[model samples]
Target chain A: MRSKIGLLVVFTIIFIIPTLNYAFAAGDEPGEYLDRRVVIWNLFFRMMVVAFTIGAVVSGTMVWLVWRFRESNPNAKPTKYEETGEW
Target chain B: MSEHGNWAEWVYIGVVCALLVWVGAEAWNVERLVEHVPADAEVIKVTGQQWFWSFEHEDGTKEIGELHVEKGKAYKFEVTSKDVIHSFNIHDYVVLIDAVPGRINIVWFVPDEVGEHEIQCREYCGLLHYNMRAKLYVEEST
Candidate 1:
């Protein structure tokens, strides 16, 4: 249990902290392309980055789950049928 | 669904809560001009008709189809409509305001680029909505 907490803290410091900083830095870099000098552009760029990151993670997880439970794998068998009795 | 899943569940909830806080903070800080408009900001009165846009400057100058503004200067647009509701939209600047009859909507923008930008009606006001268009000319400030 202590090891798990330690791993979470290390993961956050090494990965999550850098990701947060990079996200903020990414927002400032798109000002050159925006037409108006508005802060909304920076926020918009940041939103898009976060949204895309979430979408990629969700889609990747879905793909992995589908592949893991595919019919091709002999170990991936169906659990119980709702219509019939125990088999 | 396991007996020893409390820690993992708590971690998931914590992460979700953090993400929510981050999103809420970003939204709360979104740039919006509610009041205290700069005194030196150029005021442009925009009146939208069924198929045309009219611009009026503080100097009593009227311009149709094209509006000229100085680059690097702040501008506040007092937008309204003559007959129906129309959306005054400048795609490049990401400025959009509803021009409703009997009410004035105010939106502001600072032009940082000098060029001709296309303006169009984003709302379907009438049959000739497709023809309702204008141009914005941003010139270098003197």
Candidate 2:
């Protein structure tokens, strides 16, 4: 449980830190193309950040759930539940 | 299992809130950029056809493939299209305005520095949409 929490925090910081930096580092100065490019790049960057954040959160949740409630019946024998009929 | 359900709900809410905050902050920043247009600039009417751009400056100077503007002056670009909808995007300046027929979309910026900026058609109009490009030349005031 502690390891899972640590992993979640590490992943969160790794993904969120860059997004925070990018969000704040967007152009604040006035220049010819520099500021404009920064703005455009910021848009694309933010989109990426959002995607990464969502992915991290979803995957993290899945990992947490798997770790928390995985199959504890280690001694149970495998049942023959194969599908043999073909269409 | 039911004990963890509340925790899951909290995590879901937290994620949603974070996303909302992120989107809101970005929207505010972009809105600020869009609202501010410098004064003392000329107006240029840019019309996009199938594969080219037509530029008309305030001084009645017309050109194709190249646009010229004086440095340090704000230039208002009135963008429209002749055929299908196209987006006039200046990648370096981060200016993008959709060019639609019968409607004028306006974007303005001051070219404080003198250089050549590349303009591209952001919307896919046809097979040769990638070939649509124009140049913006910012020259020192004569």
Candidate 3:
């Protein structure tokens, strides 16, 4: 369980590091084209950050649920099973 | 372990709230992104035909297949189509405005450098649409 948590944290960091760098590293110069481009690109970058944040949260939740309900846990109950095909 | 799971859920909730706030801020700031035509901007009439573009200056100077403008000045292009719908696009300037028949659409841009830029029809109008293009020359101000 500790190893699983460690791996999940590492993966989350890997996903988040570059996003933070991109968020802060926007070197928009002063020009007619660049000024207009920066406004659009800033919107795109912010949207990307929101998307990545949502992805990280959802994926982290999935990992946590899996770890919490693993077979080795004595107090965890069995998950409901559904048949794949209809007879 | 149950406590840890609860904490993780709280973190996820916080992240979602932050995302919502960011979206709201962006929505409220939409006006800053809108580009308005200046009152003193130079007006140039542009007509997009089947396979070529025509430009007319305020002084009645007409140009076909090429447009000339002075650098460091904003130009408002009033565009319309002669036959079918054609899109006026300049990749270097990132200007894309649709030209529809019987309707006029205006777009403005300022060229800061002196060079020749390619003008293209983004929408497919006819068989010769691939050959529909023009040149925009930004000359140094006298």
Best by TM-score: 1
TM-score of model 2 relative to the true fold?
0.65
- TM-score each candidate: 0.74, 0.65, 0.62
Q: Which ten residues in a row have the lowest lDDT in candidate 1 chain B?
A: B28-37
lDDT of 1 by residue, A6-81 (tens): 9999999999999777555543321222234356677778989988998899899999988898889777876565
CA error at residue B138 for candidate 1, angstroms: 0.9
Alpha carbon lDDT at A10, candidate 2:
97
Q: In model 3, how large is the Cα lDDT of residue A9?
A: 92
Cα deviation of B4, candidate 1, in Å = 7.9
| DockQ per candidate, 2 decimals | 0.14, 0.11, 0.06
lDDT accuracy of residue A24 in candidate 2: 69
> What fnat does each of the candidate structures reach?
0.20, 0.16, 0.02
Model 2: per-residue lDDT, tens digit, B1-142? 1123487679889988998887787776776575455455478999999999999988798999899888867778999999999999887776789999999998877677799999899999998799999999989999
Q: What is the lDDT of every predicted structure here?
A: 0.81, 0.80, 0.80
The total number of steric clashes, by the backbone 3 Å criterion, in model 3 comes to 0
Q: What is the model-wide C-alpha lDDT for candidate 1? A: 0.81
CA lDDT for candidate 2: 0.80
Which of the two, 1 or 3, has more TM-score?
Answer: 1
Q: Name the better of 1 and 3 by lDDT.
A: 1
Candidates by DockQ, descending order:
1, 2, 3
DockQ score of the complex predicted as candidate 2:
0.11
Candidate with top DockQ is 1
Instruction: Sort every candidate by TM-score, greatest first.
Output: 1, 2, 3
